[model samples]
Target chain A: MVSKELKVTTEAGIHARPAAAVVETCSRFQSRISFIKGDIRANAKSIMNIMLLAAEYGADILVEAEGPDEAEALGAVERLFAEKFRQE
Target chain B: MDGSSPRKVLRGIPVSSGIAIGPAYLFHPQKREISRHPVAPENVEQEVARLKRALERARKDIQGIRDRIAGAVGEYEARIFDSHVLILRDEEIMGTIYSDIRENLNNAEYAFYRRMNQISDRFDQAAGGFLKEHLIDLRDVASRVIDILTLSDGGKDAPEIHHPVVLLARTVTPSELAQFTTGNTLGICLETGGKTSHVAILARSLEIPAVSGIPWKELSLEPGQMVIVDGNAGQVILNPSLRDIKEHEGRRAAHWAHEQDLAGLRDIEPVTSDGKYISLAANVELPLEVESVLRHGADGVGLYRSEFLFLGREDMPSEEEQYQAYRHLAHHLAPRHVTIRTLDAGGDKPVPALQVDDERDPMGWRSIRVSLRNPAIFKVQLRAILRASAAGNVRLMFPMISNLQEFREAKRLTEQAREELRAQGLPFDENLEIGCMIEVPSAVLMAKEIAREADFFSIGTNDLAQFTLAVDRSNERVSDLYEPHSPAVLRQIQMVVEAARSQGIPVGVCGEMAADPYLALLFIGMGVDELSMSPGGLLEMKRMTRAISYEDARRSAREALRLGTATEIHQWLEDKFRDLFVRLGLRRGTGAG
Candidate 1:
C-alpha cells in the first residue's frame, strides 16, 4: 500500500467530474483506493462519497491505495489533481 | 400565377423552449380593443353560460399545469405557484366578477376588465415600488385571461410542419412551449433572448438548435418548405434543399459532438501541452447546481452566490438556516475552497427584507455596504459563513468593495462575528482567508492599498466593465460598449492582477470573462491565479486552459495591454490568432459573431 497527502490544486476538490475521473481511474486498477478528509473516509469508487467532502480549491486531501497497482493509482490521482483539473 | 418564388426563411434568437416548426403560431397579446356595446338579442343568459364554461376550463387548465409541475419539478419548487393559484382561486375575486356579469347585465369581458381596473386602482393606492411591480405582473393577468378566453387553437388541426418550416415569433413564453410536442418541432426562433433567457436554457437542455432576436418580418418565409437552424452560430437558412439539409445535419452533429467533447473533458487534468497548471472552479448560485460543477470537473466551488436565499422571502433567513445552507455546501465541498461572497443583493437586485432605501443613487448603497448599514442582516450572514468555515475549507468574499476603509469595516465586522461565536462557546475556523471583489473601477485603481489589508482579490468583471465604460450591459443599445476586450477594461483587469502579484496576494477573475474561452488566455496572460464562473462554462474552460500555454497567455496579456482602444485590442487579438480566434467562435467586427 502507498499513501500520501495530496493538495487539491484543481480549484475545486473532488468535484463530480474529477471524482468521476478518480473513480474511473481507481476502478481501472486491480487495487482499492480511498480518499480521507479529516475523520471521514470515502470509497474512491463513489462520486457521491467524494463530493460529500465538499473540498474546495487548494484543499489537501489524503489519498491511499492498496494493490500491486497502488503505485500507479497514487501517481495517477496525484497527477490528475496537481494538473489543476484541465481536461485534456 | 407566379407561384415559384420559394420560401424566405428568417433567422432569430430563440429565448424560450420546445422547437415549434409549425406555421408561425404567433399570439401577440395587446390591450383589448374597446367598442361601444350594441344592444344584444334575446337569450343573453346563454351567452353568460358560455363565458362561465370557458372560465372554468381555463381554471382547470392552470390547475393541471400546476399539478404537473408540482409532480415534475418536485413538490417544493411548485410551491411558488401556490401563491399564483390562491390569487387565481380567491373567492373574493371570482364573486366580484361573477356578480357584475349577472346582475349588471354586462358582458363577461366588460365585467372582467372592470374587475381588473379595481385591482389596479387598489395597487395604485399602495406606496412601495416593489409591491407595485408584483401587482404589475398581475397588470396583464386580465389580458392573459382574455387571450385564453379567445384562444380557439384555430388551424392547429393537422401536424403543422409536415415537410419543414422556420418558426418565427416576437416572444414565446414557458406556458406556450409546455404544450409543444417533439413530433411537431424542428427549430425555434425568437425576437428576444440571450444566454440567460429561458429559451437558451431550455434549448440547451433539450438539445435543440434555437436562436433569438431576429425580427420575424425581416424574413419572407413560405409555408410547407425546408429550413435550417444554426443556433450555435445564430444563423438560419430558408427553403433549404436536400443538399443543404445534409450539410446542416452534419453541422448539427459536429456541434453536438463539440458539446460531448467538452463533457468528455470532465475528468481530464487541465494541464497544457507544455503542462503548466491553472486552477479552475465554478461560481455557483445554488447547491443543486453543485452536480453541474462536479460534472464539469471543477476543483470545487470558488464562488457561491448567497443572494438567492434572501430572494422571494419576506423575512431574513434565521442564523441556523443560513448556517445550515452554508454548512451543507461547505461540508459537501469539504477540503475544497468555497469562497462565498456576502449577500450580493442590493444595487440592481433588491430584497424587501432589508428595506434598503430606494434612492436614485444606489451606487454606494449596495452589497456589503447595505449589509453593513443593517448589522442585524450582516451579522446573520457573517455568523453563518463563520460557522460554516469549520465544517471544511471555506473562504469569505465581500462584494462591491471600493476602498480600503470598506475592507477595514468589513474585517472589523467579521472579527466581531468571530468574537461573538467565541463568547458563545461555538467552534469556528481560527484562520479564515478573507477577500474582497474588485468590481468598482476605484477598487481596481486602489487595488494595492486594498490588497495590503485583504488576503485576496477576486475581480467582478461584469460590474467592472459596465462601470468603467458607463454602459449598462443590460441595455441592448449600448451593450456593445461593455466589452471585456476593450483596452480600458483589460487594463483595469491587468492592474488588479499586477497589483495583487506585486503585493503577494492571491487574485482571480470571477466574472463572465472567466468563462469565455476566447478570453481565458488573456486572463492567464494577465497573471490571475484563478478563474471562476458558472459551472456550465467550467469544463469548456478546463479544456481551453489545457490547450494553451501560460507563456503564450502572458505574452498575449502584455500585447493586449499596450493597445489604445477596445476595438484596437479586439482587432489585434483577431489579427494575432486569426485561426485560433476562429476556432474559439468569437465574433469578428462585433462582440457577437
Candidate 2:
C-alpha cells in the first residue's frame, strides 16, 4: 500500500472538473484508491464519491492505494494535487 | 368528418395568428413516475443483464453528447459530461444495482432509481448543501439512465414527430420546443405562457400558429386526434364536425392570403402619412429568431431576453456558452441594435439554477436584485455581453430596476466587467449603451434620476400594469383590473417618456402594448421613439403606422390622457378609431362599423 497526504490548492477546490481529473487518474491503474478527509473516506475511482468529500481550498486529504500498481497510482494522484488539478 | 363524436371547443389567448388543422401531439418530456414491481426468481439474471446493458448504453449516449459539445462548444463545457460518463461507469453504483436485482428481486429501473435517490439524499445532507450543484449533475445522470431503462421497457421517450402536428403541452421550454423539426410542428397549444413568453416569441418567429392559457386538465386529448388550431380566434376544436372543418379550411386559406398580402409591406418604411417615423423592431428570445426578425424587416431587436439560454438546463450557462449566443446575435444583426436584457429569472420566468424560490412574488428578489446579490454570476453575464459588443452593435438593459441605487450598482458591475476585459487585453465597445427597463412604478417615479445615467429606457408594460394596479395578471380574479390602457399606466408612461426627453436619451416601449394598434398609437403620440413586439406584429404595425396621420394620433392621445377611467379611455379610443381601424383592416369590419 502507498499513501500520501495532499492539500487541495486550487481556488475552487476539488470541484467537478478536479474530482473528474482525480477519478480519471485513479482509473488507469489496477489498484484500489481511496481519499480520506478527516472521518470520511471516498473512493477515488468514483467521481461522485470524490465530489461528495467537498474538500475546499487548503483542506488536506490523505490518498491511499493498494494493489499491483499502487505506487504508480499514488504518484499520479499526488502529481494531480501538486499541479492543483491542472487548473489555473 | 366525425359526425358521431361531439365537438369540443377550447378558448385561449391568441399569441401567433394563423390556422393549423392537423393531429395533436401531446408533449410530456419529464414524466417522473417510476413503476416499482418485483422480478421473478427465474428472471433475476435477465434483469441484472438488462441493467448492465442500460449502463453501457447510457455511457455511450453521454460520450456522444460530450464529443458533440466539444466539437460545437468548447472542451470546458464538454468536460462536464465526462463526469456524467464516469458516474455511469461507477462500479459502486452498478454493483449495488445488480445486487438489488439479484437479492431483493426488484426491477432494474426501481433498483437504479432507489439507489440514485439514496445517493441524492446523501448529497443533499452534505455539509451546508455545497454539493447542491453536484446533486443536479447526479440527478441529470440518473434521469438519463432511467429514461433509457424506461425506453427499453416500452415507456415514454421524447415523441418523434414524423408528420405535421399541433404540439400540445402544459408548458415547454425553448430547448424542449427546439427538439421538434420546424416543418413537422404545424402549430402549438399550451396550458400556460403569456402572449410575450419565450415559446410565443419562437412560435411567431417560426410562423407557427400558437395559442396559450388553455387549461391542460380540460384538454382530455388523445395522441393523433384530429384537431383544428384557429390561432386567429384563439380557439382549438377537437373532433370537429364536417361543417366546422370546412369553415376552418376556408378561413385558413384566407389567413394565408392575408399573410401573403402583409408580406408585400415588409420593404416599406414604418412612416406615418404625416411623415413621422416610428422604429419598428422585434422582441426575440432565441438566436434562431434572428432570421425571422430580418425577414420581417425589423429595425433591430429591442428586447433579447437572455434568460432563455439559462432555462431548460440543469446547470447555469458557462461564459463561453453565453458569449457564443450573444456574439451570434450581435454578429448577424450588425448595425442593427440588439438590446440584451440581463437575467430576468423570477416572477413568471423561473430559473431553477438561480435558486429563485419565491417566483410568485414579482416584486421580490429578481432581475437586477438577483444579479446584484450574486456578483459572480452577474459578472460572467456582463463580461460575455461586453465581449459580444465588440462584434457588432450590442446594448445591455437591466430588468426590474426600481430604484436609482439598483441601476447604479448594475452599472458599476458592468464597468467592473469592462475593466476586467481591459486587463485581459480583450477588446470591447467603450461606447456600448446601457439601458434600464421601466417596469415597476418606482422606476417610473425615479426615471429622471435613472435617465441621467442610463443611455436609454424600455418600458415593459406587462409588469408596469401589474405593478401599478397591484393586480397579478395571472390571477383570474384580479386580471380584469390589470389594465394597460388605464389612465394611471398611461400617465406613468408619459412621465418616463418625458424624463428620457429631459435627459436627452431615447425611450422605447417593448411590451404587449406596443403591438396593439391603439396603445401603439398612444405611445407614438407620446413621443416614444421605438415600438418592439413579436415579429408577427411588425408588418401589421408597419401597416398601421402608414395608414394614420401622426398629427391625428397625437391629438387623440392628448385628449384621451384626460379621461377619468380605463373604460372611458378604452371606449373613446374604440369609438374614435372605429372607422379608421376598419378602413385599414386593423380590426375586423362589421357591417355596423
Candidate 3:
C-alpha cells in the first residue's frame, strides 16, 4: 500500500462531489482506494463516507491505494490533490 | 419607465416570471466578429492597425470595470477582472507572440493568437463548463479594447431614462448593478441568476424589486426599446402597445399603494375583520431577507430556510460561524419569533458530500435523513439555533419527517442538544418550540402522531405537492403534473389541518403555495393559523383575505377538494374570483409575502 497525506485545495474540499470525481478516476485502475483523516477511514468511492469526513478546504487527509497499478493510482491521486480536487 | 412607445416585441423563457414597463437597457449587445483569415501583404497594414485598435479598446473596457469596482463594492470582488487585465498585460506571453515569429505588427498579432490559444487551453482546465464559457470573458476584454479605440460606448450609451428606470442586463457585474441611482433605477433585471447571486442580494438590500435570468438571448433587444419588466414575472415586453403599458401602469401603481397599506400592518396583528386573530409570519431564506419580511407586515419570522446560507458557500458552516449568523438574525429581529428550519438539502440541492442514496425518491434520503445521519453536525446547528434563541424569540424545526419515528428521533437529538447546552451553561431557551415541515404524504398522515410530540407543523406545499404527485417540479415535462391545488394534495393538506386543529396545534405555511395571493383566502380558511410568505405578497394576501369572508374560503376549499384536477380547481377559482384573477393576472409566482 502506498500512503501519504495531502491537503485538499478545492474550495469545498474532498467532499462527496469531489470524492466521486476522485473515485470515478481511481476506479478505472486495478487499485483499492481509501481516505483516512486521523483515525476515521472511509471508502473513497462512497460519497456518503467522503462527506462524513467533513474535510473542509485545506484539510489534509491520508490517501492510500493497494493492488495492481497502485503506483499509477498514487501518482494520479497526488496530481488531483495538487490541483485541489476540482473536477474538470 | 420611459420611451413608452412600443419598440419591438421580444420573447424568451421566463425565469422570474413578471412584467413591467420602462425604457430598455440592452446590455451585452452583439459584437461584429473579426475574421481569423490569413492576411495578404496588401491588407497586412490594415490588419496590424485593427489589432492595435482592438488592444486600445480592450484596455478602456477593463478600466471602466476597475474604476467602478474601486468605487462601489471593493477591490477584492473585482480581482477576477484584474487577473484578466494581467493576462492582457502578460509580458512573457505578449513578448513570445511578437518576437518569435514576426517583426510586423499585424503578423505579431497572428503569432500572439497562436501563443495565447495555448494559454487558453491551460486556463480552461478548471473543468467548469460555466468557466469554460468564460472563454467569452477573454473575448469581452479583448473586444472592449476594440470598442474603446472604435468608440462603441458612444453608440451604445446607457439608455436615457425618461421616467424612473428598471435596468435590464444579462448577468450584470457587482460593480455595474450596485451603484445604480434612484434617479434612474426603479429596480434592475439580470438575465442570469436564481435567488442567490450576490447581485440579487444587493438588489434586495437596496429594496428595489429586481428580477434575474430572463433569456436575453432570444429577445428583440434595442437601445431605447420601451419596456416593462415585471421583476416578479420575469416578463419583458419591448415596445409594449399603449393598452399593455396602461395595464401594467395600473398594476405597478396599486402595488406601490399596497406597500403603504402593509406598512401599517407591520406592527398591527393579522386579525381578520372578525375577532379571529392569526399569525402573519414571513418565510425567509436569508437573514438579509429579514428587512423585506419586516417591511411587509410580518409579525414574526415563521420559517427561516437556513439552506440559503449554505448556497454558494464552499461547505458546511462551522458551529461558531453558524452561531454568529443565527445570533445576528435573532438579534436583528428581536422579540419576534424566528423559527429556523435546520439544514434541509434535498432535491437538486444536495451538498457534494451530502448525497441522497436515491435522488429519484426525495423520500429516499435528504433533509432530516441527512441530518439524522450526521448527528454531530446537527448538534452544531441545534446549538447555534438554541444559542441564538437566547437573543430573542427563536425556535428550530426539521424538514422531511414522514413519520413519528423520525420526529421522535429528531426530538431526541434536540434534547441531546439541550443537554449539551446545559453542560456548557449556554444561555438558551430550553423550552423553544421544535417544529417539523409537513411535506411528505406520510408526514401528513402521521401529523397527529408527529404533532403530539412536536411544537407545530409548517406545511411545505412545494415539496408536499411534488411528493404527493410523484413528480419532479424541475422537470418541465412533469412540471405540469406537480400541482399544489389538486384534490390529492388538498386531501393531504386537509389531513394536516385536521390533525393540527384537532389537537389545537398552530400550523403555518412557508412555501410558494402560501405566498400565492389567489390561494391566500383558501390557506387562511383551511385552518392555517399562520401564513408565511414573501414580504411582497403580505399586503396583497391581507387584501385578498379581507375581500373574502372566512366563510367564502371554506366554501372554496370544500368545492376545490371535490374537483378532479388542479386545472379544474384553477378554473373553478377563476370563475368565482375572476376579478381577483384579473387583478393578480392568474400569473406571477416565485415572488412573495
Candidate 4:
C-alpha cells in the first residue's frame, strides 16, 4: 500500500467538479484507492463517498491505494490534489 | 395518505400570474417505465450482459447531455454531467448490480434500482451541502441506465397527457416548456428556478400560471392526481380536496371579473383625471404578441425585444429574416409607433452563432457593448430596422448604452446601414427617429450627453435597478436588493427624466417597473412621456393613470424621492396606493388581477 497526505487547496474544496475529477482519475487504475479526512474515510473512486468527506479548503486528506498499481495510483492522486483538481 | 385523498400544499416563488386547478403531470425527462421480474436461473448471464450494455448506453447519454449543455450554457455548468458519467461507469456500482442480478436471480432493472437506492441512501445520510446534492447526480445516472434497460414502445411523446395538467418538474428548459404548451398544460411547477429564468419568462409570455422553487422531489406525486397551482400566491397543492377546488374556483371567478373590469378601461385614454396624457404602450418580444398589444388598446409597440429572433436558434438571423419580423409588427401596428430595440444579445440572450466566449459578466459583454464590438452584426440588424421602418412608423432604439461614446458609436452604425440602403436605392424610412435606453448608472449620470445625440429616451428600469444597486436581479439571494422603488433607483429615473426634458426630447419607461401600478403612477407623476409593459398590464396601468390626478402623482413622486431605503419607498407606496388598488378590486399580490 502507498499513502500520501495532501491538503485541498481549491477555494471550494472537493466540490462537485473536483470530486468528480478525483474519482475519474482514481478509477483508472486497478487498485483500491481511499481518501481519509480525519475520522471520515471514503473510497476515492466513488464521487458520493469523496463528497461525504466534506473536505473544505486547507483541510488535509490522507490518500491511500492498495493493489498491484498502488504506487502509480497514489502518485496520480497526489498530483491531482496538488493541482487543486484543475478547477477555475 | 390515501391515493384518492387530498395531499399537502407546497409554496414557491410566484413567477407568472394566474390560477389553475388540474391533474398533476409529473414530468421526469429521465423517468423510465420499467418493471421488475424474477429472471430464470439459466438466463442470469443474459441479464448481467444487459446491465453492462445499459450502463454503456447511459454513459453515452450523459456525454450527449454534457455536450448539449456545454453548447447552450457553458463549460462550467456542463461539468456537473461529468460526475454523472463517472457514476454510471463506477466499478463499485456496476460490480454490485451485476452480482445482485446473478446471485439473486433477479431482473436487471430491480438489481440496478436497489443498488441505486442503497447508494443514494448513503448520500442522504452523509453531511449536507455537496454530499446531499450528489444524490441528484446519482439519481440522474441511475435513471439514464434504467431508461436504456427498460426502453419500451409508446412511452414517449410528452407522457401521454390525456387531460389538462399542472406540469411538475425539477427544472424545465424553454424548449421543453414550449412542447408542453401544445398539450392541455394548465400550469407549471418547478423544483428549482427563479423569476428571471428563461422558462419563467416563457411561462409569463404564454400567460400560464407558474410557481417555481418547490422541493418537488420531497413531495410524493402521482401522475394524473389533482393539483392546484395558485401562481399569484405561489402555492401548489397536490391532490387538492373538493373544498380546495371550490375555493380556488371562487378566486378564479373573482380574478376573471377583475380582468373584465380592467378590459373595460382599455378603450379609455391613459390621461389623468387632471388631463395629463400618459402614453401606454406594450413591450413585445415575439411577433405573435402584436395581437395582444393591439387587443389591449396600446398606443404602440414600445421596446420590441429583437433578441427573440436570435434566441434558441442555431445561427444568426439574416438581415432579411429580421426585416420581415420587424416589418410584420410595424405594419400590424402601423401609424402607431414601433420603437424596436437593436440586437440586445450576448447577456442572458447569448447568440450561439456569435460565439461570444465571455460568460464572466453576461451583462457586461452584452447589449450595446456586443453590438459596438461586432459592428457587422450590428449593421445587419440596423439595416433591417431601417428596412422595416419603410413598412410603417418604426423607430430604432439601442439598449445598455453606458456612456455617450457607445451611443454615438451605435448611432454611427445606424447611419452606415442607412447609407448602404440609400446607395442601393432600397426604399427605406430616411427620417426614422432614434432613441437610447438609459439602463446603466453611468448613463444616468451622463444622460445629458447621451440625450443630445438621441431623439428620445426610454428608461429600462429592470437593468437600471440592477446596475444602480450592483445587484444581479436573476440571483435569488440578492433579488430583493434589486429594487426599482428604492430611493437611489428612483432618483436615477428622476435624473434621466430631467435630463431628457432639458434636451427637449420625450422619455418613456419600458421595464417591469412600468407595469407595476404603484410605480406607473409615480412615473406619470414624474412627467414620464410614456410607459410600456406586457399587454396584461396595459389596461390596469391605463386605469390607474386615469384614476389619479397628475398633481397627486407628482406629490407622491416627490415624497418617494425623499425615502432612504427600498422598504421605506415600498411602505409609502403601499400606504398611498393600497386603498385605490383595493377599490379597483386588484387582489393583493396578484399581478394578473
Candidate 5:
C-alpha cells in the first residue's frame, strides 16, 4: 500500500472540478484508493465519495492506495493537488 | 364556487416585465412511485440483470449530458456530470446495491433508493458548504436511475402541451426550464424561487412573462382555465371576471393602436423640433427581425446578437456558415449600419460547444470570456463579421467587456482575423469600426481607458443594471431589487457617455431601458447619441424623440440624476412626461399608476 497526505489548495476546496480530477486519476490505476478525512474514509475513485468528504481549503487528507499501481496513483494524486486542481 | 366566479387575485414577485393573458397549463411532474416487491429466489439473477440494465442506461444518459454540456459550455461544467458517471461506476455503490437486491430480496428500485439515501445521509453528516450541496448530486443520480427503471415500461408520459399557456408549477429547475421553450410557454407562475432563479432569467431572455412566489398550489387552476399573468404588476388572476377581461382587452387594444399611430411616423426623422438629431435603432436577435427594423424606420441595427447563429444548434458554425448568415443580414439591411456583436455565448446561454459549469456564477464564463478563451471559435466569428462588412454597412462589437486588458486582447484577435483575410485576398472592409459593449461595472468604471481602443461604446443596460445593482434580475426574490432607473445606474450611464465623448466616439444605449419612452428621453438628454431597442419599440421612441426638445430632455435628465432613489426618479419622469405623452397621443393606459 502506498499512502500520502495532501492539502486542499483551492479556495473552493475539493469542488466538482478537483473531485472529477481525482476520480479521473484514480480510475487509471488498478488500485483500491481511499481518502481519509477526520473519522471518515471515502473511496478515492468515487467522485461522489470525495465530494462528500468536502475537504475545505487547507484541510489535510490522507490518500491511501492498495494494489499494483499504488505508487503511481499516489504520485498522480499529489501532483493534482500541487497544481491546485488546474483551476483558476 | 361556479366556474364563472372570480377568485381573489394572487400576487407574486414579477421576474420579467410583460402582460400575458392565456389559459393555465398546470405542470405537475408525475410522481415516480415504485413500491418494493420481494423477488423469488429463482428470479434473483433476473433482478440483477434488470438492475445492471437500468444502471447502464443511467450512465449513458449522464454521458450524453456530459458530452452535450462539454460541447456547448466547457470542460469544467461538464465535470459536474463526471461525478454522476463516477457514482454510477463506483464498485462499492454498485456492489451494495446489487447485494441489497439479492440478500434483502427487495426490488431494484427500493434497493437503489435506499442506497442513494445512505450516501445522501453521509453527505448530510459531512461538513457544510460544498459537501452539503452535494446531496443534490446524489439525489440527482438516484433519480436518473429511478427514471430509467420506471420509464422502462413506458408507464408515464410527459405532459402533452397543445397550446401556449401560462405555466403554473410548484418549482422548476434550470434543466426543466430549458425544455419549456417551444413557443407554447406563454408565461410562468411558480410557487417558489426569486428573480435570480435560472427560470426567471430564461423567461426574460425568451421574452416570456414570468412571476414567482405565488401560491400556485392553492389556486386550483384547470388545464384550459383563462389565466392572466400581469408580470408588470406581479399579479396572477384566475377566472378573471368578464369585466376584468374586457378592461384588460380594452387596454391591450388601446396600447396596440398607440403603437400603430407611433409606427405611422416611421418616415419622419427622429430629429427634435429644436433640431437635435437622435438616432433610433433596433436591437435584433434573428435575421428575420430585419424586416420589422426597416418597417419601423430604424436608423440602423444597433445591437445585432450574432449568438443566435451559434445557439439552438448542434455544432459550432463554420466560417462559411456564419459568413453566409451575416451576409444575409447585411444584404437585407444594406446601406444601414448593423453593429454585429461577436458571439456572446456561454453564461445563461447554453451553447453545447462553449459550456463551462460554473453553476454558482455563470456570468463569468460568458460573452468576451468565451471568445477570449477559444480563439479559434472567436476568429471564425470575427472573420465572418469582417467578410459581411464587405457586403454592406457592417460594424463589429464585443459584449461583456470587463476591462481594458480584455478589450485589448479581443481587439488583438480581431486584428489577426483582419490580417488573415487580407492575406487570403478576400474582399472585406478594412476600415470597419470595432466597438465593445460597456456592460460590466468594471467596464463602466474603466470606460475612459477602454474607450481609447474602441471606435464607439454601446451600453448593455440589462447587464449594467444587474452588475451595478449587484442583483440577479432573474431571481424572483430579488427581482424587485433590480432597478434600472436607480441613480447609481444612471450615474454610470452618464460616466460612460462622458468617456465616449471625451474620445470623440459616439455612445449608444441599447438595452430594455431604451424601450421606455421616459428613459429614452433621459438618455438623449444625458448626451446619448443613439437609442436601440426592439423593433416594436422603435417608432414610439422616434415619436417621443421628435416631440420633445433636446434642451428640455437635458433638463429632465439632470433633474432625474439629482433624485435620491429609483421610485423618485420614476415618479419624477412620469409626472414630468405625463402631459407631453398625453398631448402626443402616446398615453395607452400605461401611464405610471
Candidate 6:
C-alpha cells in the first residue's frame, strides 16, 4: 500500500473537470485508489464521490492506493494534482 | 349534453388563424410518472440485470451525445459528458443500487431512484452546495437511466403521432415543433408563449391551427379525447358537444372555400389598376418552405430567415450543410431572386452554439453585433451563400445594421468570402446584390448613407415598431404600445423608401405589416417597390393590389400620414377600405355595417 498527501492547486479546485480527470487517471491502474478529505473517504474511480468531497483550492487530500501497482497508481494521482489536472 | 361529453371552453391568445378538430395528444415528456412496485424474491437477479442494462444503454447515449457535441461545438463543451460517463460507470453507486434490489426485494426503478435520491441529498449538503452544478449532471444521468427503464421502446423524446391530433404542451421548442411537421399534428395548444413567439411563427408558416397561453392545469383531458382548436378566436373546447363540432365544421368549410377562391389569383400579375407593377415575395425559414413559396406564386423569396437553421440543434451547421440548404433554395427557384438573410440570432431566438451572454437588454449584443464579433462563424455562412450564388439568382442581406460602419464591415467580410471562393477556383455571381435590413431606428436614420453602399432595402416593421416606440412587444404590459400603424413607424418606412428611391434601388416591406391589405395599400401609396409576407397571404395581397388603383392608394396613404394618432390613422384607413375589403371578402360584414 502507498499513500501520498497532495494539495489542490487549481483556482476552482476539484470541480467536475478535475474530478473527471482524477477518475480517468485512477482507472488506468490495477489498484484500489481512494482520496481522503478530512473525515470523508472518496473512491478515486467514482467522479460522483470525488465531487462530493468538494475539495476547494488549497485543500489537502490524502490519496491511498493498495495493490501490486500501488506505487504506480499513487504516482499518477500525485502527478495529476501537481499539474492541476492539466486544466492550466 | 345530448348523448355526448360535457363541453368546456378555454380562452387564450390566437396566434395562427385556422380551426382544427381532432383527438388530444397531451405531451409532457419531462414530467414522467414513475410508480414503485416490489420485486419478487425469485426475480431479484433479473431486476438487477435490468438495472445494469439500462445503465449501459444510458452510457452509450451519453457517449453519442458527447461525440456529437465535440463535432458540432468544441472539445471544451464536450468534456462535461466525460464526467457523466464516469457517473454512469461508478460501481460504488451501482453496488448500492444492486444490493437494494436484492436485499429489499425492490423493483429496479425504485431501487435506482432511492439510491440517486440519497446521492442527490449528499450533493445538496456537500460544501454548502458548492457542488450543486454537478448535481444537475447527476440528475441528468439518473433521468436517462430512469427513462430507459420506464419507456418500452427505448427513450425517444418526441412523441410519435400516427393520426391527426392536437398537440398540447407547456411550451414547444422550434426543434420539437419541427418533428411534428409530418402533418399528423393537426393543431397546437400551449400553456405559455404568445403570438410573436418562434413557435407561433412556425405554426403560422406551416398553416397549423395554434392557441397559446392556456394553463396546463385547466386542460384536464384524457388521451385521444375530442378537442377543438379555434385559432381564429383563440379558444379551445374540450369534450366538445356534437352541436359545437357541427358549427365549427361549417366554419372550416367556409374557410377552405375562401382559400380555394383566392387560389385562382395565383398566376395573375400584381399590377395596380393604374399600370404600376409591384413585386410580391415570400419570407421563408426552412428550405422545405420553397415548395409552398412556389405554389403561392411569389416573385421570389425576399426574407429567408437563415437563423432557423441553427435553432433546435446543439452544434453549429457546417459550411457544407449550409451551402447545401442555400443551393437547394437557389437551384429550385432559378431565375426568381432568393434573398438569404445572414444569421440574426439572439434576443428571443437563442442559438446554443453562439453562447450569448445573458443580458437584461434584449437589443444588446445581438443580431449583426453577434455576427461581427464572431467573424469565423459569420464568414462560414457568407461563404456558403456565396457558393450558392452560382446555382441561381441569390442575394445576401444583413439584419439589424445600426450604421454604415456595420454594413461596411459585413460587406467587407462578404467580399472576403467572395475572394476566397474565387481563389479556390469556385464559381459565384460577380454582381450578386447585397442589402441591409432597415429594422433598427438608427439604421432607418442612416438609410441614405447605407443605401448608397447597398443594393436594396427590406423594412422589418415588427422590430422597427418595437424599437421606435420603446415597447418590448413580448412584455404584456407594453405590447399594446407596439403599434405598426403609428405615425412614427409609417414615417420611418417612408424615409427608407425615399432613401432607396434616391439611390435608384428598390425597397420592400417584409414584415407582418405588409400582409395587411390596409397596410399593403399604404405601402404601395408610399411608393414602396415591393412587399414580402408569408406564403399564405400572397394571393390575398395580390387580390387587394389588383383591385385598387395606385393613384388612389397613394392619395389615401398620403392623407393617412397627416393623421394625428395611431387610432386616427387606423380608423381612417379602415373606413376608407372597409367597404372595399367587405366587397372583396377580406372582412366579415355584420349585415347592418
The segments of candidate 4 whose C-alpha lies over 4 angstroms from its true place after superposition are A1-88, B4-16, B27-128, B131-160, B169-176, B189-202, B211-221, B232-236, B264-277, B284-291, B304-396, B412-433, B466-488, B547-583, B586-593
lDDT by residue (B327-425, candidate 2, tens digit) is 999999999999999999887666655666437887786788888998998999999999999999999999989899999999999999999999999
Cα interface RMSD of each candidate? 20.5, 1.1, 15.1, 2.1, 1.7, 0.9
Question: In model 1, what lDDT does residue B117 have?
Answer: 62
Q: Residues B252-359, candidate 5, lDDT per residue (tens digit)?
A: 566556656766798999998799999988877667566777888999999887876776444678999889888888888999999999887765555656653333
TM-score of model 6 (CA atoms)? 0.78
Counted clashes in each candidate structure: 33, 0, 29, 0, 24, 0
Per-model TM-score of chain B: 0.68, 0.81, 0.68, 0.78, 0.71, 0.85
Model 6 chain A, poorest ten-residue lDDT window? A79-88
True contacts kept of each: 0.00, 0.64, 0.00, 0.60, 0.62, 0.81
lDDT, candidate 5, at B180: 67
lDDT of 3 by residue, B1-593 (tens): 34444355443333332345676555442232122335466765555555455555565566776666655445544444544554455443555554443344344333545555554454345333323444555545544543453344333322334567567676664434433543466656666655534455445434556666566665555555666766555456667778878988887777666556556655655666665666777766656566677677777888787765554322467788888878877888888889899987765454433433226456666788888988877888888888999888888888888788888888898888889889988889867888889998988878888888778889988889888888876566877787777778878888998998887778988777786655666777787888886655565566555556677777788777788988898778767886664564334331332
DockQ of candidate 4? 0.48
What candidate 2 gets wrong by more than 4 Å, as runs, is A1-88, B1-7, B29-158, B194-198, B217-221, B587-593
lDDT of 1 at B370: 82
- The Cα RMSD across the true interface for model 4 is 2.1
Better of 4 and 5 by lDDT: 4
Q: Write down the TM-score of every candidate.
A: 0.60, 0.72, 0.62, 0.73, 0.67, 0.78
Ranking by DockQ: 6, 4, 2, 5, 3, 1
| Top-DockQ structure, candidate number | 6
Q: How far does residue B358 in candidate 2 sit from its true spot (Å)? A: 5.9
DockQ winner between candidates 3 and 6:
6
Q: Rank the candidates by TM-score, best first.
A: 6, 4, 2, 5, 3, 1
Please tell me which model should have the higher TM-score, number 1 or number 5.
5
- Compared with the true structure, model 5 gives a TM-score of 0.67
State the lDDT of candidate 1 residue by residue for A33-65, as single tens digits.
888878878677654345445566666789999
Please compute DockQ, using alpha carbons, for every candidate against the native two-chain complex.
Answer: 0.01, 0.45, 0.03, 0.48, 0.43, 0.58
